[model samples]
Target: MSPMTRRTYSFLRTSRFLRPHIIALNKPPFAIPAYQIRAMSSGNPTSKMLTANPLKQIFSQESRPAMGVWQMLPGANISRILARSGADWVMVDCEHGNINDAAMHEAVPAIAALGVSPIVRIPDLQPWMVKRALDSGAHGILAPLIRTVEDVKNLVTAAKFPPEGKRGFGSPIAMQNFNPMPTFTEYLQQANGSLLTMVQIETQEALNSVEEIALLVDVIFIGPFDLGNNIGHPIIEGKMDPELDEAIERILRAAVTAGKKCGIFCTDGEQAKQYADKGFHMISVATDYTLLGAAMADSLTIARGQGKQDKPVSY
Candidate 1:
């Protein structure tokens, strides 16, 4: 028998004692009233979020941590390497390292094409730089110099879209597949979740407020050199200084307490492992330029050792 039969309709039409949902199959599930409907008709909200975020499941499931690399390789091929490496994420350093939009245009899409998350570390927490990186197809932004919770709030405002942020919408941009017909309402809804905002907590002032900063930031990356400097211990000391180490520990503790992902750069694999063990999920291993310089110096040293005295190179 047809479920929506004339008799059923007549009964519903004439009766007021019914559940008001006699034709329950016609109702939408997960609605305002929360009525039960066909299982296939509605999608799970948590599952949808998980499907959208690769790291969502990682953070939810057992302790599978993510390691990041600060790949500043030129010509934009950096993205492909990160995508194929099965890395949890990567950062395109446009900060103290050498990078420009000319390079970012190629790198951002290349990274996106490879399906690895590309985080752009802008030179500063400038709004234009933030917008430019996003418009170029970056999935997240790793901004630096977050001294307090107020700084985090400001950065968050810049990273978000209308009512939450001030990012200028560009539907014609390549990020939307260059779709010229994106509805503003639909685009705004997607932008909030699709975009990830991160801020750095590397200074003494920042460390003092690390707990508050962590609570406000989505992801946090540490500037090791700057951190050491801010803590009055230069990296030239050649080892993790006592105060700097303690400060890092403090930040990690606060981050854990706030349930936010903490990140920092390691001088090498061993250092990275140390930080990871200390409860850092998002870790930046090395920079492409630094790796190349170190490799070349090591190769030259090896060649010289075969013929003459060895002398290590320095920047």
Candidate 2:
């Protein structure tokens, strides 16, 4: 029997009490109350409900940590390169990066083509921005400057679809990210729960409400640049400042307590490893621009040692 058939048979066989209420096995899955179905499955104890999104599956497994790249430049080439770089996901930055709507449209597919999840970081908590990101086939959203629980609630609504949220869905392109593409109804049914909502806790206001926000979103991401700046320490001498470390600890505690994944921005692999050691579920290891800059600088140094010095190339 197929998994669905097996589940159905198991539910009917084990849930003798539910048989009286359930019309028939031929009835649609939606016909049964969702809670009763959950109860039946929970009672069975052998079945597992899995998330369809590739990136989310990383967090679903406890031992596997998620490592991602920050896409600063626009286009499919950059996105494709990063996606195939063995990272669990890629964060296409629309907020800080030069990516616009046009670039995102092209970039998301390239990322998905590599079977990697594309997470878009929108500039603000605007619904239109969230809708545009989602419509472009993004698997998740990283919303910055989330200052309160209310902000998180609105962002969640914008990210999710009807019944659970108010996000309007008509994107034919969005399902392209799914492997063995699902029908629109199947996609809609899973979309609200599958897509991740990562809220950046950067400001003092956000830090204060970290516990509540942790309960609201899937991931609690710390924007070190903004967090340190707002905390009046500016992340000078790395993110090791006592005050900033305390704040990071606080946010980490909140997420751990709420049973949510925690993430943070890192400047390089070293910093990323440090945070990962500290138990961050997700880590943005490095950005395209930073990698490129370091590569070019190393190449120039190699050329200089070979006595092949020519005119310097300026950006």
Candidate 3:
């Protein structure tokens, strides 16, 4: 017998699981194996799986801040276009945006399919809202108006599965957005650990318990406009009050001390860069509505052949 035939016979003898199948076919010992032929027939027989969350991957890079955009308009195409803009994450703003539950459902998969994390900013800290957001395959839930440590705890409970929190599972479509599409079992295994839980510290009550709340959530996001208003230091004449600035710094400090990520809202890239340099882990660079309005206004000014008009101030 040839050496190659002898080796094939040896391999078949050793592979007890394949021996019966191979023998039943009554094929030549040197003939190509069934497994090899199957693998060859299947184009790119390699499987792809998610190793980590996209936002988590950004956060893991030391000194690199995650730049995000807020989606106030509700459309899957709009969400996909924004995701293609190279933002690390996109906030589907249900809290203040025109997005309803149906729109959110459409936007989440669209955003996620582009490898950008879709973080849903729910209208409130209600558990049902949290459940709905998570069930839609959101990578995270940003609960607005968190007022206490208990609120943070409850938010976490609603976002996680059992043994960590009380969230229930059974979404057949949740895993569809993931690249190469993980099985339901794989999705369940990674969901709790991969999903981020964020609470917005925009109220005076939440500010007072910032430190305690920071310890419970993965991120402490500050809504500067609402925070200033809630704390009786609303931004006046387009200028931030020193008191509001101090409160913002305090929240940043609390988040840092607790070893949690800190995020804030900014109107432009310059403002986002400033916060990023100030040790904020996540920063929202702009909202969809504002960007569209600003771009159109600038375009119209240029078309009129007028001296560049001063940009309007926005929060």
Compare the candidates by TM-score and give the number of the best one: 3
Q: In terms of lDDT, which candidate is stronger, 1 or 3?
A: 3
lDDT of 3 by residue, 1-315 (tens): 789887877787668765543443344433535553333212121222233358866765556899999999999999999999999999999999999999999999999989999999999888899999988888788999888888888888888765577877656566666665655444554666666889899999999999888888889999998999999999876689899999999999999999999999999998888888899999999989998988888888889997566866755
The better-scoring model by TM-score among 1 and 3 is 3
Using lDDT as the yardstick, the better of models 2 and 3 is 3
For model 3 the local lDDT of residue 217 reads 80
Model 2 lDDT at residue 264 = 90
**Model 1 C-alpha lDDT per residue in residues 1-315, reported as the tens digit of each score:** 356565665675456664332323232211212221122122243433224444433555658567767777766666676667677667888887668888877776676565566678988878888888887767678888768777788887777765566766543343432122122233344555545678887788888888788887667777777888888986774566788778878877887888877788765666778777777878766667766777787777678785433333221
Score each candidate by Cα lDDT.
Answer: 0.65, 0.79, 0.81
TM-score of each: 0.74, 0.81, 0.82
The positional error of residue 40 in candidate 2, measured at the CA in angstroms, is 19
lDDT of 2 at 229: 88
In terms of lDDT, the poorest run of 10 residues in model 3 is 40-49
Clashing pairs in 1: none
* lDDT of the structure predicted as candidate 3: 0.81
Candidates ranked by TM-score: 3, 2, 1
